[model samples]
Target: MNRTDRLLAIVLELQGKKTIRAEELAARFETSVRTIYRDMQALSEANVPIIGAPGQGYSLMEGYFLPPLSFTASEAVTLLAGAEFVQKKLEPNYGVHAESSKAKIEAVLPEQVRLEAEQVRATMRFFSAREAEGSRRERENMELLRQAMLDKRKIRFHYAKTTGPVLQRESTRVVAPYGLAHIQGAWMLVAACDLRRDIRHFRLSRMSGLEETSDSYELPPDFNLEAYRPRDDRELKVILLADPDIADRVRESDIYYIDAFEEHPDGLQIKLRVRRMEDILYWVLSWGADVTVLEPESLRSRVVKEAQKLLERY
Candidate 1:
């Protein structure tokens, strides 16, 4: 970048961090220490409040602030896109905040850039939240869970398990929440269940009568989420042959189960490793006649049996 842009970026960087060494800035900007020193001198000459000390680092003087900067057309569009995502994917409260934030940003941006960003936002859409069907109570629960996680406090809620098409008996649960994850279009809370003395994943939709408790607990430092995640020990390699017409679409998806794909004269040969045979079976069935199970006799037989049952019903 040019020297003028580098000088401005250095000021922004200092504003972000408490202190930055000349060496660190040099590496970050891909320049020599001498160039950094010169840049720092230039900033100070321009009346930018920068303090420097030996054996320490460079820092912005206390109470020093930069003037509001203009956003480029690209930057404005990027920010608007992120706001649009938060509005569509997150809960109602967050969606409100996202809209408010977008308005504030637009108010400060150049009119031309803001107008361009609006056009970009109009072109995108999200149907995930609609499919998930979040209610007001669920949205409130999500916010409460987030607050509890941040405060390191306990939460109490009545949870019900889905038994077939109906819910079974409801049970009161008190737990210390660790994190929240969106999996397969559902919101799940990962927490340490006090009753079970183990970590469990609770669907937020299944929880009701939520309340935050005064009890606090420290999370174990050694607890790595990767280690705590559920893993399938048994690896089953399965293969499929798909018609060339929809092969590219399947390949573009990059499903987690798929390992590789090879082109055949009539179709695409796909290889996958899955923990459960049913997983691959359902996925292959989704393609209908476009895909055929090529290996693992058990999977092929299961598919044939299911297809025959469907035919019999028809």
Candidate 2:
């Protein structure tokens, strides 16, 4: 970016954060520390009210604020689309705020820009993939869990494990709530499980009879929800040949573990990496004869056995 844009961005960054070091600004703007120092000097010369300390970094002066900035039509549309997604996907508490935010953004846009943004927004739509019953339950659980997290309380609930053996299907759990994550169209609670004595992720849809307990707990000092990423140990590689007719459908499904797709004379060659054979057994079964497991003799044997069982049942 040009120096003019960089200077304005630096001031905006300072306005947003409590303080930022020269190195941090340099990294954020993808420039050198020397350039950052020169930019700071230029900003000070322009009377931007940036206060710098020897070791404390830089911050905007108290009560200093930037005037309203204009947005391009595309930018306005992007913000509106984000607001719309939040309204449709998140719980009601956030949905209300998103609606208000959308209104405020629309109020500030130029009439022509607003019209263009609205036209672009109208071309797109957001819809919940979940059923009404599941969506309602998830929303209720999300609000309750959000409150529990804020209050630093433990919660008790009956959780149903959709996978695994039937005997271990359902169990009551008492957990110290940490945070929630929305992954692949589902809400998952990341918590400290009292029973397992470790952090676990529980799907909200599978939870029943959830209630906050009188007990309270403190979050771990080192744990940060925004920085948390579940460990992935998917080493097993499974290859499959999919019928050409169904290739488009498979691509549209957006299966998370699909590693690559290659065109073949017979059909499409699909490469999948997963944690275990069982992790993708059902998905493979769903495609029936259209998808043939080419490797991992174990998965192939399991599929044969399962198909035999189905035949016996019929």
Per-model TM-score versus the true fold: 0.78, 0.84
lDDT per residue (tens digit) for residues 125-146 in model 1: 6664444334445566898998
Model 2: residues >4 Å from true position, as ranges?
1-4, 22-49, 164-168, 233-237, 273-277, 312-314
Per-prediction CA RMSD (Å): 4.1, 3.2
Quick one: best TM-score, which candidate?
A: 2
lDDT (Cα atoms) of all candidates against the true structure:
0.84, 0.90
Model 1: pairs clashing at backbone N, Cα or C within 3 Å: none
Candidate 2 steric clashes = 0
What is the overall TM-score of model 2 with all chains considered together? 0.84
lDDT of 2 at 41: 97
Model 2 Cα lDDT, one tens digit per residue, 8-115: 889889989999999999999999999999999998998889899999899999999996588889999988999988888778999999999999999999999999
Q: Which ten residues in a row have the lowest lDDT in candidate 1?
A: 128-137
